[model samples]
Target: MILALDVHYKDDGSAKSVGVLFNLKDSQPKEILVAYLEETDEYIPGEFYKRELLCLLKIVEKVSMHDLEAIVIDGYVYIDNEKRFGLGGYLWQTLNEQIPIIGVAKNFYHGNNETVKQIYRGKSKKPLYISSVGLELDTASDFITQMPGEFRIPHLLKQLDTITKEK
Candidate 1:
């Protein structure tokens, strides 16, 4: 199964992390997991993983590691050309580098070229930035480009975002 994850922060110092499991061939999620974190690490500039990684870990506990083909996060895996560990990278390490983690971001990270791939979907000229660990950059980009969607963001991914934001 391929899992996509996203986190929504609330003003009360809480957060909701949502995970959607789907096959590459499917357009819909097979299972959706939601984790409510009563308190999360305060966001630290240049160290975003500290605030969101725990939320992701909470949702990850709902699934078996062996069954995951890859995990998609809503941020970058590598932060720059030198390949610093981002949220997805930290998650990969926490999992002992066993499962692949794909970081899909809506915006470009400046000075990042060696590890980032820009993919445009549908008729949208805007591209989605893609990065990863445990998988070739080209392979990871192909997965995102070919995912079942007619728009810039995959249908299942947008659904996952909505799930995280819903009250």
Candidate 2:
């Protein structure tokens, strides 16, 4: 199974929603699911990080964390010991070999090389940033191509994000 996850937060830093696109089979469309915590506070740096971990843990516990293909997180992850920090890396460290994580971010600031990089909407624009962490898989471009929309956000995940704010 393939799990495509997009975690979105409010400007103030609260965890607004967590959109998930899952594929139980290889030759099938993805299933959309949204997990939202109604009562939450502003996303302070330390608080946000802790809450983020809790949110992910809750989602995993709600479902089956066994026999999973991948958990694709949307954000940056710095592996090297450089002067930088990453959102996904924190999760990776927390998971601590529990589950394999694949970081598929929209944009990248580091001047480095990636296994997968390509433009989504425009052909003239620079490629998007899609890298892996625990699981060494090359499905970055494939995920973007599978998204049923014309924007950076994926179709199922985007709807999940929108519905999360409806309340």
TM-score of each: 0.98, 0.64
Query: Mind giving the per-residue lDDT tens digits that candidate 2 earns over 1-167?
Result: 55655555665545544545466333323555556665455557534455566666555555566746667666555433361335566766776766666665566555535443544653325455655556543554565556566566555545655655664
* Candidate No. with top TM-score: 1
Q: lDDT of each prediction vs. the true structure?
A: 0.93, 0.55
- Clashes (N, CA, C under 3 Å) per candidate: 0, 1
Residue ranges of candidate 2 with Cα displaced over 4 Å: 8-14, 24-33, 38-48, 79-85, 110-126, 137-153
Checking candidate 2 for backbone clashes, the offending pairs are 13-43
Cα miss at 109, model 1 (Å)?
Answer: 1.0
Model 2, residue 126: what's the lDDT? 48
Which whole-number lDDT from 0 to 100 does residue 133 have in model 2? Answer: 58
lDDT of 1: 0.93
- The predictions' CA RMSDs to the true structure, in order, are 0.7, 4.3
lDDT of 1 by residue, 108-152 (tens): 888887889999999999999999999999999999998998999
Which parts of model 1 have CA positions greater than 4 angstroms off?
none
- Cand. 2 Cα-lDDT: 0.55
